[model samples]
Target: MLPFQLAEIVNQGKLVSDEIIINLLSRRLEEGEEKGELGFILDGFPRTMRQAEILEGVTNIDLVINLKLREEALVARCLGRRMCSQCGENFNVASIDIEGENGGAPMYLPPLLPPPQCESKLITRADDTEEVVKNRLRVYHDLTEPVEGFYKARQKLLEFNIPGGISESWRKLLEALNIEDSDNMRSAAA
Candidate 1:
């Protein structure tokens, strides 16, 4: 099972000990290795130096994408974010264009939204509130920021600006990974 799945199990009604977290994560890493998986992405794990050390023992990590954003923008982006209730599609309210508005209003869907429709209203996540987001950011700075330096010293960090937009950053990531043509990168695999 994936580490996140193990995390969900650990998070159910109790706090998971660091030993348990490390064991579960190590097992998942081993499973991925046995299956010959490449370019594994571990989102929101290894928040501590110990965890990073354990990961170093398990396998080599190729790239680390550190998204840099201003604290104000981080809060605003989290506040303006919305998700599809049915399909779990994420969209930012700021990125969507409103129809017949004077450019200050936020809309759930962009003007000239394509069919077929989602039907469900885009809803804000419970954890997206100001207080919760601020706390999360605080925790990140306290626990996770050190990991960036850890990887940076190893020459594996790629810091990207969020205001540059995801698509542009995505292309930069492709370049970082030495992927010349992202379109053909997948087809070549198949």
Candidate 2:
């Protein structure tokens, strides 16, 4: 998922099933259409060529948002990721909101056992490592390429260089959708 924030919460830990993805997306689209809204924020769906075809034919894909991040940056960013010991919370030593007990960030503990000292809410999976992240990113890119082309051909794909990273990327995304403030967006979220 380009927006890894949302789909990363799946309990299956990235072992996503096509049936589950399609079913959820279909349901959301159906609910939206019934209400005459016709909108949804699909994160990390349509992962395969077949899945992309299914999405194109099913909801008709009004639009697609793609973020382009450099491979090195993605690798570096992913490799440096450290998850919380208690709650499966993710953090980057290099990114914002870093916290530590001894005035420094603590080591991530996998779900096997809770840290006696940390007491985090969720367990950091074994897969939250550089090797795993790089592998995941590679798989993500492979899956994303065809979908990008598919939507591009339909004039539904929008790509942002997002060279300035997430905050700038989000600002541009909201602006592109003509969403000036949170009020209008609140309706969908609520």
Candidate 3:
């Protein structure tokens, strides 16, 4: 577990030290291996060049999917995020509708409105403020962006632009991965 101090720093939108993350990751990977798991998907790891190098030494990564979103949309979405204090469920109040320019694809993400019961209980996350979200984006550009080039050079990077809301994006993502949409598969997974 991360020390409380370091965890606090992370909650402030700062990147933690590579050594700490690497050690934690190594332990998890070992556990996964011991469980006879064939593969794993890491959502947000290898955020820095050092972490990427270390991960390369430990495993064979087949592909990296980079989901691209407009900065404005990203900021708005982050800031609009809320959690229900009573039930601990997450929701988004941001209704983003951005028109594309210069032949770019338009983006639209409707708000994930909460039920009536949880409406009054919604609370903004401390880190979802504009300042913190912007800081996180800056940190990503400085520290994590390089990892994209590292994977690109290895022909393992797939840059995917998020077209719209969750359903549309999910369909596009499935298509990108050449995964056919099947009711049985979705129900079984659920």
Q: Best lDDT goes to which candidate?
A: 3
Model 2 weakest lDDT span, ten residues long = 105-114
Model 2, 1-190: lDDT tens digits are 4336445643223547677677777887888888999457777677678899887678666777786655555655655565676555565543323234465433222222235454444344456666677678777878878888887888888886544445555677788877776864687689
**Best-fitting candidate, scored by TM-score:** 3
lDDT of each: 0.67, 0.63, 0.90
Ranking by TM-score: 3, 1, 2
Mind sharing the TM-score for model 1?
0.68
Say which prediction, candidate 1 or candidate 3, comes out ahead on TM-score.
Answer: 3
Q: Model 3: what TM-score? A: 0.91
The better-scoring model by lDDT among 1 and 3 is 3
| Candidate 2 lDDT score relative to the true structure | 0.63
Kindly list the per-residue Cα lDDT of model 3 for residues 93-148, writing each as its tens digit: 99999998898888889999999999999998777889999999998989867899
Write out the backbone clash pairs for model 1: none
lDDT of 1 by residue, 1-190 (tens): 5677665643342234568777777889788889997757877666777788888887778877786766665677777777777777776765432333375333222222222455356777666777877877786688777898998999988886543456555676677667787576788998
